[model samples]
Target: MSFKTIAAILQGEQEFQRVLDCAIPLASRLEAHLVGIHAEVLPVPYTAAAGFPDTDFIQVSTELNKEATLKLRGTFHERVEDAGLSFEWRTLESFSGDGTLAGLPNVRAADLIVAAQRDVESDDGTDVESLVYDAGRPVLMVPHSGPILSSFRRVLLAWNGSREAARATFDALPLLIEADQTDILIIDPPESSDDTPDAAGSRIAASLGRHGVSVGVSVRNSQGQSVETLIQDRLAASGADLLVLGAYSHSWLRELLFGGVTRSILRSAPVTVFLSR
Candidate 1:
């Protein structure tokens, strides 16, 4: 499937420009309708110890939010117009001040979502796992610091033959079809009664091959290395621009409590990561 509508979740000023740096060109190339979504925080009423309202606090908060909202809206429009792409700009005001959360309705309607990795120093972050798990769509996360390529030449697809793995592969078909090379990497593949160890990633490789993806498979023993580490090394070694994987292959609670591959990679990875639930 091709992307017809692309939503760029602009979390804040510091990082949204970088996200648009990737999204604008992609939308232009795909000829998709691009939507920029931002949300302003609604100030809550403040009261002093004497039960009197703090007008200064409320007014300052309100003005700051409005200023930020206006600034982002202006920048988004200017970039889209400069790119000459069909687009829409959405703005919202809510207590959470989360652009991603506020834009859920629009995000659900889009074919794909683009989000950025969090920059802790600047508080430029979003609940990206929600976008992956809740959006019922594929999400491409750009690293807060990395080389953002106009086009992905090599794709590293982590496959384990699980339902989630299968979902991510097909979801990434549009890019896989266009990529110069796609390596299906399976680490510590499970021993199956019906399939041999050597045949682990072959089926999916064949499936993607049929879709015009130049594909290959790499089955390896983790050798005491964590799955996330092995995957990271593979991306760097292969010079891959993209890493596609199933998000939360384990149960969400288990992953959250004990730590898991999804969380590890999401926290930091050198390449742009593509995820699907």
Candidate 2:
């Protein structure tokens, strides 16, 4: 249940240090091999009126991208060498619009993926959503604006009694077992044929308790507020260092159209989020 290999996605110079700040400590703690993945995007050449390619534009863009990749690689090597962690770097040239797709293969091979939270302001062309949904591995998303967490001491699990929730609960077992406190929080729980609202989080609490996790259950009525809002409020109030939850319990298409819980939380989670599909 422990991570043996960690994949850290490096998008740009701005996020590289922050992602490494989180990934290095996590790898050190888990004693896992760290793999740094960078996707160098190739700019598309424009066609002339006669369909001739713009060679000069293409050449300049290629050189700039190459230089940027080299600089990022150098920084990665320097940091990893100083950290003294077992590490490797994988760099790929991506021609597609989504640069992060270039690192998909490495991400698929790793036990866990560490990535920076998406920057809504910039269109950097990185596809973190694809990595999270398609990587076939758990992803720990570091907040874009927060102090990096050295350890997950207090964990909060968002449970909804769905298959995805159950999967996430077990997928995060190692962290939960190690946490000093793990709270199972259920909001606006649906009335199941077998379970009641008052006891919504009881089942999962019991299961985690059996695994030797210091677990507690809390059920809160949404009271017409968005579930995402409540989750953030709770995270702030409890000062939980990490949040564990299932990703896309609803279909991706549905979430895109209707704004599901997973999407909301992914956009603005207050703490580090561990998500498993």
Pick out the ten consecutive residues of candidate 1 with the lowest summed lDDT: 118-127
On TM-score, the leading prediction is 1
Off by over 4 Å in 1: 120-123
Candidate 2 lDDT by residue in tens digits, 1-277? 7988999988788788888999998888899999988887788878867789988888888889889889989999898888889999888888863445877777888988888888777766356667778888888888888788857889989998888888888988888988999988998888978889987888789889999999988899988898888889889888899999998988999998988888887777868899988
Local distance difference test scores for all models: 0.86, 0.85
Q: Could you tell me how far off, in angstroms, the CA of residue 171 lies in candidate 2 after the best superposition?
A: 1.4
Clashes of each: 0, 0
lDDT of 1 at 33: 98
Each candidate structure's TM-score, on Cα atoms with residue i matched to residue i, is: 0.96, 0.94
Error of 2 at 242 (Å): 1.0
Give residue 191's error in model 1 in angstroms: 2.3
